[model samples]
Target: MPELPEVETVKRSLERLITGSAITDVNVLFPKVVKSHTPGDFKASLAGCKIKSLARRGKYLLVHLSGDKTLVIHLRMTGRLVYLEEKDDLPRYAHVIFYLEGGKRLVFADMRKFGHINLIPTAQLKNMPELKKLGPEPLGKEFTVQYLQQELRKRRTKIKALLLDQTFVAGLGNIYADEALHLAKIHPERTAQGLTGSEAAGLHHAIIKVLEQGIKNRGTSFSDYVDGEGNIGTNQYQLKAYQREGEPCSNCGTIIERKKVAGRSSFFCPQCQSSKR
Candidate 1:
C-alpha cells in the first residue's frame, strides 16, 4: 500500500503529465474498479473531459476534471498508473485506460484488482462518504501539535494503533508509522493517552519529518509502487527502522526489532524506545 508520500508523488507526476489533456475516451475493462457510477455512466461522464489538476487527500488521488467532476482513485495494494503512447502495448494488468488526445493513454493497472475509481461532482466531493470522514492531512495546516495532542489524549489504544487510525491522522500507513514511531523513540505499544507533552511534541515533529523526507526521496517502493512515469521510489533506501529488523539502529546501535501490533508489523529499537513509565 502506498502511503501519503507515494500518493503525493503520483499526484505530482500525474499533474505534470495529464493536466490540460482531454480525455478522448474511457475504457473500463474491469467494471468493478468503477466504484461510484455504472460503467456506462462512468465512461459517458468522463469522455472528452479535460483534466485540470491532480491532488491527494489522505491516501486518495483526486483528479479534477473539467465541468466540475472529480475522479477519485484509491490505489489499494497493486495499482499503478502509467502514461504511454497509443502505439505502446498496454500492461497485462491494465484495467482502466483513459484514452487522451494526441495519441496518449493514461492506464490504471492493478494486479490485485483491489483498487477503485469514483466519479463525483466536485461540489459533492467534500460530502462524499470516502472523503468526508477522513481526518486532517498530516502535512496540512489543520494538523497542529495541539490537534494531535487532543486526538491522542482521547484514545486508550496503543500509540501505534492510534496512529494507524485514519480519523486520528490521515495518510499514515504501517511503513511510515513504524518509521515515525522509531524516530520519536516511542514504543509502539505505549498507550496513546500516556504520552507526555514532550513525547507528543516529539512524535508530531517526527511524523512530519519522516513524511517530508519520504516525499523528497520520491517514496518507499517496497512493492509494485511506481510514479506515473513507471520509476521506482528512492525512499526505500533511506528507511531506518521499517524492514530493518535485527539490524543496528542508526542512532544508538541498538538492535532493531519487529513485533505485531494491531495485527501489523511494527519495527523499533528496543533500547531506544524502552518503556519510560
Candidate 2:
C-alpha cells in the first residue's frame, strides 16, 4: 500500500500532468472499482469538468474538479495511476480511465482490485467519512509533541500498533513506522503509554524527519508503486529499517531484526531498540 509519502508524491506528480486537462469521457471497466455513485453518475459528474487541483489526505487522493465535484481515490495495495499518451496501449489491469481533451488519459490500474474511487461534492469533503475520521497529518503543524504524548497516554497498545492506526496518526504504514521508531531508538514492542517525555519528543521529530526524507526520496518502491510518470521511487535505497532484516543497523553495529506486530512485519535493531519501559 502506498503510505503518506508515496501518496503525496503521486499527488505532486499527477498535479503537474493532469491539471487543466478537461475530462472528455470516463470509462469504468470494473464497476466496483468506484465505491460511491453509479458509473453513469460518476461519468456525468466528471465529464466536461476541469481539474481544479489535487490534494492528499492520509492515503487518499482528492482530485478537485470544477462544478464542485471531487474525486477521491484510495490506492489500496496494488493500485497505480499513470498518465498515458494516445498511442500508448491500455494496461491490462486498468479499471478506470479518464479521457482528456488532448487525447491523453489518466489510467487507474489495480491488480488486486481493492482500489476505490469516490465522487463527492467538494463542500462535503470534510464530512466524508474517510476524511472525517483521519487523525492529524504527521507533517502538519497540528501534530505537535504535546499532542502525541497525550494521544499515546490513551492506549496501552504497542507504539507500533498505535502509529499504524489512521485515527492515531494520519499517513503511516509498516515501512515508515519502523524507520521512525528506529530513528528515535524506540522498540516496536514498547507500550505507547510507557514512552518517556524525551522519547515522545524524539518520536515526534523522527516521524516528521522520516516522512520528509521519504518525500525527498519520492517514496519507497518495493512493490508496484509508481509516480504519475510511471517512475519508481528512490526511498528504498535510504531505508534503515523496514525490510533490512539481518543487515547491520545504520546507527549501531547491531544486526537489524524483523518480527510481526499486529500481524504486520516490523524491522528494528534489537540492541538499539531494546524492549524497555
Who wins the TM-score comparison? Answer: 2
Residue 73 in model 2: shift from native, Å? 0.7
Best-fitting candidate, scored by lDDT: 2
Tens digit per residue, CA lDDT, model 1, 236-259 = 999989999999999999999999
Worst 10 residues of 1 by lDDT: 268-277
Candidate 1 is scored at a TM of 0.97
Model 2 pairs whose backbones collide: none
For residue 75, what is the lDDT in candidate 1? 90
